[model samples]
Target: MRSPLRSRLVLLSTCALLLATLSGCDDDSGPTPDAGSQLPEDSGTPDSGAPDASTDSGIPDSGAPDASTDSGTPDSGAPDASTEEPWDGGYTVLEEHGDWIDRGRYAPCSFNRQGDPSTVRCDDLSRYDLSQCSPEALAQLDAYGIYMTDLRGEVPRSDGGTGLLPAFAGFMLHSDGGTDTMNTAPLDFRNTDGGTFFIGSSRTNPITGTTLTALAGCQVPSPGIITGCYARCINGSFNRAGTFEAHRMPSHRGESESSGGLRLISESPVAVGEAVDVYVTKNHAYVVSLDRISGTSGGLTVFDVSDRAHPLFKASISLPGDSSWNGVWAKGDALYIAGNDTGTLIYDISNPAQPEYVRHLPAGQFGVHTVLVDGNRLYGMSPDMVTLVYDVTSPLAPVLLQRITVPEELSSGGAHDAFPYEGRLYVSNGFGGYSVMDVTDLDNVRHLGQYVHGSFAHHSAVGTFAGRTIAFEGTEFNGSHLRVLDVTDPTNIVKIGEFRLSPVNSIHNLILKGNHLYAAWYQEGVRVLDVSNPTKPRQVAHYTTFRDGDPGRRGILFEGTFGIRVPGDGHVYVADSVRGLLILNEL
Candidate 1:
């Protein structure tokens, strides 16, 4: 496949060809033999009446053609087909039939023969039927800038009908009714040359002028000669940040990138904080984002919570990892991010647009998994099969107080996520039962307990609402399940209950606000669960944003919504694998 750039170039070249033909200006190669062929052999269907030899135009002699010819009355506006013969040998036959002959000085297919030499060269023949020209222009209608084999560029007939060229190489139409219309993919000059063509959002060939090159080496009527190249192209709007129009998404539904099948009610209109790893909270709002395609990493978005009617993005803090960001938690002005390889990063977003990096946690961790701020205690999971607890009573400095090593054999330790509550931290070990840890003392840690019934446990969240401890872990790889655990009694963590909100699975992340648990379910999308009861959770309603539409559409939901949380108000955010951060309001 030609790169997207090449394909677009071809399309434009073809369009130019169509325009040239309509304007009666054939390429220097002239039209094929019938177009400017001076030889008699090409004057196949010779006209009966010969052109008066006195005429300067060197048209082949076909006997005077019957006045009623296919190309219309011999008006000066159009070529005098009546007197022209299809043969190029200059012999005029008495037979009256449909044929055409060329009669002008020819221009060589002029081009920079050797790099940049000087002025282009020109020479020879003025007429040749499309079939008798150089392979460059002969079978490749696009060669002479002829868009299609059909006579579309022909002088518009008085009947308001159009003439069309023949399909690719089968020049002689076997019969009438054989023209392919524009509906079958517009002919890009490149594509007509058998090159692959790039399609725009509208599927129209968006080739521009400068990019199309006349690759004369290609065979006429053969594949690769015309189909224009389909190059891999990225969807980018020329506009830079702050200037991005809402039209950024594939409004026309063209081929887009691989997202979590979740549609963005609004794809991150704002690029920063896109991979929303940074969490910010204020008197007004909370939010996250799916960053931009540029830069090695994306960032976290902060919102103004001062007013519910309008939640504006107040700041964006970038993560240090060269990879995209994953999770974010903010305490006061300090923000913690799950930096891909750079480990957990702490930053002071007090100066948001210009964040000040504070400290970096240990490495070999992925996802930083999940983070929680309990007073001065900081808890986070490292993909390395270990969970770390930190004492951050000192704002600028965080002391790594403890690390509990969990055996990989005990838990896949795909140790996806963890969150601290009361004095215990609930850790969701991928494929491992949730592990409970006691961190009453930041420096001292103890295994409070664990629930070993295999829970998909990719991530977990703890909410202290109504004086009760409700811990949630995303278990269903593709369903909406707030794996509710009663952690009120930390020493004995129990999977008291679970609330399944939708048929589509893929429960990725969940966050509790007030009495509700905002679950970012992959294909099942984002749902608001009323978790007033630790043992039972119910969904109030759902906003069908742009999720995979339904969970497990194909036995498995590929549209992955990883992080879901409601920073505040009616807005629920979901980070999609395909689409960055999807911001939406609950219905």
Candidate 2:
């Protein structure tokens, strides 16, 4: 038997080789941001922070087409699936800079940062539901610079961290912990009369004057619907964030969990549910797929998996009115989750199977994205892109202690994932990269430093065990790579090394198991690495869960893959575009 140290080394070596092979994939460019109602007519009003009355909805306006989404052909652009000059081509724009730069067309959409302007063409915004099209319509939702709208198109499943949800036309698929697609529901972008859930550029934009080609040219979707996905596509600019069309989840009747087989599952659309997240105990694992129905309390599902090969249906718990949700963490007797719209929710999951709501703390923004509980306080990032600090000492009624606005220039008002270590908070500033802030003064978390070049840095994990901090910044469009920084001294941060694997450009979530770091490589797959040396990171073992071969019989169809940690377990939970939830052991 190999010693623990040798085992870790071997793991690192395997992960390195796999990462090397996958480092060649990609996120869509974020839309122009900050063009909120308060800003001047031309000045973009991106509201990545505190959504106020201005978060109201409005009729789609026709300014210079949404950035690079348009070609030089102006509003009367072509209507083909493929373009002759690449639609928005010739210009070095963000397309050339890879994920490092967010290139746009003329006027550069709303926020207008990328220097490249559309020659004259325009973007297609027809597929997104007018209601859900505003803020997120043009915004890049994931860390890998992947536009949330990307989900609007295809759902291609592959391996590593990216795979199709375990489903078959409105049905949830269930399996053991090996299921990486803990996907609750499909993005449901098919607002059309009777079209498929997936949207396509084949459709034409009736309003933008630009054709389908014009939209895809700039890497955007064709004009359409996004009831639950439209207008809310920018920072602080939420004209609409998508309508909540409650649909009863089709009841799934199949073999009981006692049978070692996979099943399809889904959240009841009409019923409110608790926040969605994953948690772990010494050797056990569980996923909390919560729901915050529009106007009702939420619910949760507890999957008991003492047997890695088989997860038993433990218990189901309900919480206060539909409290929207996100990231989840569990302490002694309580499970804490960032309830997107409901604030922070705490539940008693000591029973492993059955869980009960213990406490909750409302948040500033309507939804909470990422969260971290340090000592007695819980730190949450609201969808409005603000940091909300809560006092969790009183678990029942957690007090809202403070909320801080990230530096405008540094964070796009969007805070995705964050971790507090050594008197400081390290936040993944969405498209803004990784930021180190001094949260010692909770009320006033000072910006200690930042790593700005990583583009759409979605999630980060600090190697506290090794006294080192590492940022797994996601890069789409080929610029995606792992940026390792030396944060021993938060004030003076530096990028010591960047690990890249071809064919696998985008990286989502990562966790350090023992001395080896396992990462979810978007299209590439799951990667294990050796972080023995913080400054110099290396790869080890890699399992292409969804590669063409379909070795393990797990879902191989990969969509935009995202990743996360499974609490105390040595395994990691990777979220595939359509896959339900993937549970990978730390072997």
lDDT, candidate 1, at 66: 17
lDDT of 1 by residue, 1-587 (tens): 11111101222243345433322211111111011111110000000011221111111111112111222222222233335332221211122111222122122221222222222111101111122224443343432211211111122357997443211111111113233212122223222334312111112223211121111221233321232111111121110000000010111123233222223344443345334332334432223333332222455555543443344565555544343455656555666666545567787756544457777786562435455565675666666677777777774577887777654556754455666555666677755667777767655677666665433455566654334465666553222244556566766665655654322223556665433455655434455554444444545544343422221111112234556544433344555544545555532
How many residue pairs of model 1 clash at the backbone?
97
**Candidate 2 per-residue C-alpha lDDT over 1-587 given as tens digits, one digit per residue, 9 for 90 to 100:** 11111101222232233223321110111111110011000000000111111121111111112212322121112122114222221112111122332221111122111222332212224433233233433343111111212111112235544221110111112223232211122222321222212222211112212111111111123232121221112111211111111011110112122111111222111122322344454233434443321233434445545555555556555544443344566545556666655666777755655666676666653556666667677677764668888776764456778887678877653776676655777777765767888888875668878766635556665544232344434432232556666666666666665566532134556654433455665444556554444444444445443322222222211232344453333334444333335565544
lDDT of 2: 0.39
Q: After superposition on all CA atoms, how large is the RMSD of candidate 2?
A: 20.5
TM-score for model 1? Answer: 0.48
TM-score of 2: 0.52
Off by over 4 Å in 2: 1-211, 214-276, 282-284, 288-299, 316-324, 464-479, 489-492, 502-505, 547-561, 566-577
- Angstrom error at residue 76, model 1: 78
User: What is the Cα-based lDDT of residue 565 in candidate 1?
Assistant: 43
Give the local distance difference test score of model 1. Answer: 0.39
